[model samples]
Target: MRIDVHAHLWTDGYLDLLDSYGRTDTATQRGTGAGATAQELEARFELNDSAAITHQILSISPQVPHFEERAHAVHAAAYANDLYAGVVADHPDRFSAFAALPLPHVDAALTELARALDDLDMAGAAVTTDVLGASLADPAFTSLFEELDRRHAVLYVHPSGHDAGTPLIADHHMRWMVGAPMEDTIAVMHLILAGIPSRYPNVRIINSHLGGALPMLLRRADDQYQWESPQTPDKPSAAARRMWYDTVSHGHLPAIRAAAETYGPDRLLLGTDFPYQNGDLLRRAVTSIHDALPGQDATTVLDRNATALLNKA
Candidate 1:
């Protein structure tokens, strides 16, 4: 299928829903060069065709509508899912999506997850690394994961833009530069240490940006996780292999190669953090994989892996 497992779209209606519901954080993305106009949309699609990216699995992250207000969170999530469902319906050949859930509000998230998956027929759910400040591994999120596990759904973990609650990264202006993947590293660490993968084996968890330095840190974690995180139910490496990662390290071949070496080739999927990685960078996201690995393995990563993963639904 040549599916790109990571792409993001922020429609005007989705942004308006967030703003009307009092979400001020999303305003900056309104016209950050990735416009909602038809011309820009066609340009994006044409670029996808150039890259041989037949399909794109879109998501909204770093600016998800996860306000603490129950009404606000639920409404925003429902609107986002409906909007995504419409796009997929209108362009099924080019788009599929992970549902944005109202997290830090599990029951509501559960409800919206049901609607998005069962009714809207979206691919699966996407959540930020943390809900407000709580970790995904926290027991508070277990029920949500339980339901996800039951359905054998895909859980896309994206950075929440808050920089993993770290003062150093949050205080500095490097939030998205390195902080984005830092959130990715810490969030996945929380899951590994808390046994998220082991506990909910069926939930196909996909981490962003090559699992946020995970290619480098997996062995270090495997070495020290025993005492550092004694309560972990399984080996860090074992749990990590159960999860998946996307090649979104700004098309860095070494990072991609390291990930392929650390985790098996099957664990990697093609991704371009679109708009953010648009134009030539988007094209490079695909071509770089072929450059970094053998022909057969690159083919599996670019095409076969995502087809197998998405079809698991």
Candidate 2:
């Protein structure tokens, strides 16, 4: 059985919140499979039956509104969390959910996280790479990280809107294809450089899209660290092993192999990026991993790692 660690759902209330804030990007405009019906989910499951995906953990996509006004962001987060709670309640066997926190609004996010995990019983929290242009490693987020550490919360890091001046691959309409993963790479690098994994040892972080470009660039990062800041407490690659990564490389074999090589089968978990990827692509991605890895290693990625992560939470 496969336990897909990454999937997304959008509720009308959540979309309305984004619209109210004028946060309509291409993902939002297209709705990006957020409002899929129960029947649609079942159909998707049937389509992925070949992959044996028995469970999916749903998170709000990165299209979240990082409101400049803290109150609005908090309210939006609460609404999204409530929506996720309802989905989990209705499909307890087939689905679990992660909470959306109004990040950067550190105190409010902490409160909502407590409510989501303790009260709503969410699987964990899903956060974007940055919170209103602030990196996750910013000093302002230390309290929030501490709270997550205290609870031993499972934190899923996804890419958010990019603030780069010019879009990469804009002509190809693959901003998401290129930019999102780049953001994930940057975010993970920032967290590692700032020693987040070592500092928050108890917090279990699962970075999406095979940890973006991290697997490929980690050696370079380590070399740079050795040359630039030899005084740092830990090596970038060593700190990375303490974290987990999901197999959402969109069926890119080289990327999957790189992640598997760097993180190993134990640290790798299966992910679908559902709705965005749809069932066929999801199945293909899983198949690709199976093809690339040896016997039990593929099975470990498909089921064991995700089961372990969920059980840990």
lDDT of 1: 0.87
Please write out the lDDT profile of model 1 over residues 232-271, one tens digit for every residue. 8888888889999999988788998999998888999999
Task: For each candidate in the order shown, give its overall lDDT on alpha carbons.
Answer: 0.87, 0.82
The estimated TM-scores of all candidates read 0.96, 0.93
With candidate 2 superimposed using the best TM-score fit, by how many Å does residue 273's alpha carbon deviate from the native?
0.6
Q: What's model 1's TM-score?
A: 0.96
Over 1-313, each residue of candidate 2 has an lDDT whose tens digit, in order, gives 5688888887666677787877766344355454657766667668557678888888885866468788788988998888888878987877888899886788888899999999999998999888878888999999988999999989999888563223555555666778778888888888887889999999999998988889988888888997686755689999889899889888888888889899788999998888777757878878989888887898888878888878933
Looking at candidate 1, the ten consecutive residues that score lowest on lDDT are: 27-36
Per candidate, the number of residue pairs that clash is 0, 0
